[model samples]
Target: MRRAISRLKPLWLVPILLGALLGVLGVLDVVPDFVAAVPPPVIVTAIALGVVLFAVHPRAEAHQPHRMAAPVRGRWAALNTPGQQLPSHGSRFLGQYAAVDILRPTTPATPAKLRKAWRNSTPQEYPSFGEAVYAMAPGVVTATWSRSRDHRARNTWQSLVFMLVLEGSLRSVAGRAALLGNHVIVRHADGTAAVYAHLRRGGVAVQKGQQVGVGNQLGEVGNTGNSSEPHLHVHLMDRANPNAAAGLKMTWTDITRSEEIEPSLAEIAKQPEPNAVLSMPRNGEIFEA
Candidate 1:
């Protein structure tokens, strides 16, 4: 009976104590009648304290482990095309794909405009002069596209007016850069595949059946199929076949660490700062997490 009473006592005592406090407050008029009409403050001190704690908490920092014990003795080729000055960075590739401008250009450039005359301006239909793209990881040449003419340039006002009128029809002829035009796919050591896209027509350095090592020149950057600008696109996937390639979350070794958006050609001209590196993934390359 005592054990049962103990539990029941807590249940009854809370309400009784609350009632007694209310009675006392009513008798003493300690609480103003207007107190019932008041609203709670928008920001609570406890909540503010929690937010401060959260802001100061450390974020999750992840690092990849080096793949190879031996340091890779290779360097990435120059990304700029010969005789073609980059408007900004020495590197042709602009903006991050997955992280920045996921499907189209974010600033200064727009996808609609890029698609209007992509055949010439972008590597979607024509390869850039002397821009050799290489295999970042080894796999296969599962897909390729090399049959499209880059559009002719039009700088005049009349030409610009005409180009806008032809936007609807221009889309039919314009190729997709993100579609991995004129590309090669190779199976990576981790069972995933690496895709090299927007290769120059007739610039494919490797045959359909040839085996390539890390940094082996695969082809020149081209605007063969689907691209908005003269740049090379590389990414990792789970499948070798183009139709089935699934994007894999990946990180590269020797890559610059910073949250840079739309880095220009000039920005890429400088070598990696002391103790800094640009991302390049290759076989036998050690990756430190």
Candidate 2:
């Protein structure tokens, strides 16, 4: 069921909505004179087009997990990772099925720090802010966006509610740029594209069409776009245009260690021996690479 729904592209809604609108106008005889004068066959064709679009579900192609260098160094906690759940960001839309969010936590994890962060905090207050983001593999930079401003953290309960009810809706309607903030898309030799989003304004270090090697600096993390806090959002897609692309699974090739952050934020417990090649870290799992 989920797979079926994932196959329903947002672009399909255009024809469906258009067909419904024309049908209503025709039935009510309220369309403009030219529209009303349109032959019945034209209307039928439009409606039929909509039906065909609805029935045609695009395949959400999957690829074998690509092993690449981790985009950041030091200790960072992973959230919304593919290891924790499929469609890691809660939707297959935008080719984010294997996306992961990572943020650096304060040393000696403390409940008070977590509580303070949850209550109120600035984007710059987080350790992840301004930290350089690196390219995970060799690629040509296909696209870059850096205009969106980093907004205040929405971690507070009130702000979180506002984001869910209003800000998120506005961002969605404004399109990908408004939602991804500062971002970079790098297309690898094998055709897979790596996307790094939620970057700090004015922090983009590379330009479109530039060749970048593995570990090249891309930008810095920020709380821009649809984000609640400052973090780096990374994913691999089949192509450069996320709207038309399918997500590809990815694994980190150089993780040195990992630990699980307790729910209370009071304890950081070590996990099993770190794998040289690591799957996406689960939510609350911190790792060094």
Candidate 3:
């Protein structure tokens, strides 16, 4: 059942299901005509959601990632991005569904993992876990939040499911702040705003009105918000409010890609491989700056 729901999530079945339920209620006399009259709205919502779920494909063969300089200094994972993957495949209501979730890959197979997925180790133990998060472009700091507590890193698939369920419910009650923990927003000069979310607790290092430039340190990555592990989430938007912002393209400077299960510090030192230059990494593709 859990797997089924997870699979259905990308399809956005919940809204569609609710819309169906509303239709059934209208026809079965479960609700009054006043309520039934609102069925049009529900049907419209379902149709719109369907288009969002299946119609848009940012990473489609015809599209390409807009490359830029690397945001972080060391190794990081480029998994979900509207420019790189199907997960963030559309531009809809806001940019919430269109942001990139960045992280440094440390796994059960890494030397840091020590051959175990989880054994009471903290995300702080990994070299890339608390690495400094840097500014990608010069911008004014528009918003900042730094109070959500850092939860334990979900080191295993089993634990990750639990983390998702717990965070899912808590988010409904806590709102956007719940999904994006200690975060910072920067409105760039080009009319594009960049958001750095899920920073360490009290890890925010800049003031709301401070000016920041490319390579400026904003915060340290940590396990906060809707993350299962420590990572830095960054995305570009046309609006400061993610709810209504339109997502923009992303590209990283120099990087080297490797599929090594356990990359050594020495191996990571030899970064920006000549062949790996100027490429949008596929999912699970390891890259270092």
Task: Please name the candidate that would achieve the greatest TM-score relative to the true structure.
Answer: 2
**TM-score list, all predictions:** 0.42, 0.75, 0.64
Regions more than 4 Å wrong, model 2: 1-62, 107-120, 262-278
Query: CA lDDT, every prediction?
Result: 0.40, 0.75, 0.62
Estimate the lDDT of model 3.
0.62
The local lDDT score (0 to 100) that residue 201 gets in candidate 3 is 88
Candidate 2 structure quality by residue, lDDT tens digits, 167-286: 886675356788888999999998989999999999999999999999999999987899988889998887777766677789988986455573433342233223211466766776
Question: What tens digits encode model 1's per-residue C-alpha lDDT throughout 1-289?
Answer: 3223322322433433444455577688786666435442422333444333322211112333222211112222233211112111221111111111011112344233323442334333232333666666655555555554434333334445564576422332232333445666667656656666656667767766677676777777655444444445565444454223333334345433222222233333343333222343221121221
Give the Cα error of residue 96 in candidate 2, in Å.
Answer: 0.4
If the candidates were sorted by their lDDT against the true structure, best first, what order would they fall in? 2, 3, 1
- Each prediction's RMSD over C-alphas, in Å, is 20.3, 6.5, 8.7
The list of candidate 1 runs beyond 4 A from truth reads 1-129, 151-178, 257-289
The lowest-lDDT stretch of 10 consecutive residues in candidate 2 is 268-277
Question: Could you tell me the lDDT of residue 198 within candidate 2?
Answer: 96
- Tens digit per residue, CA lDDT, model 3, 125-155: 6555668888888889998889888876666
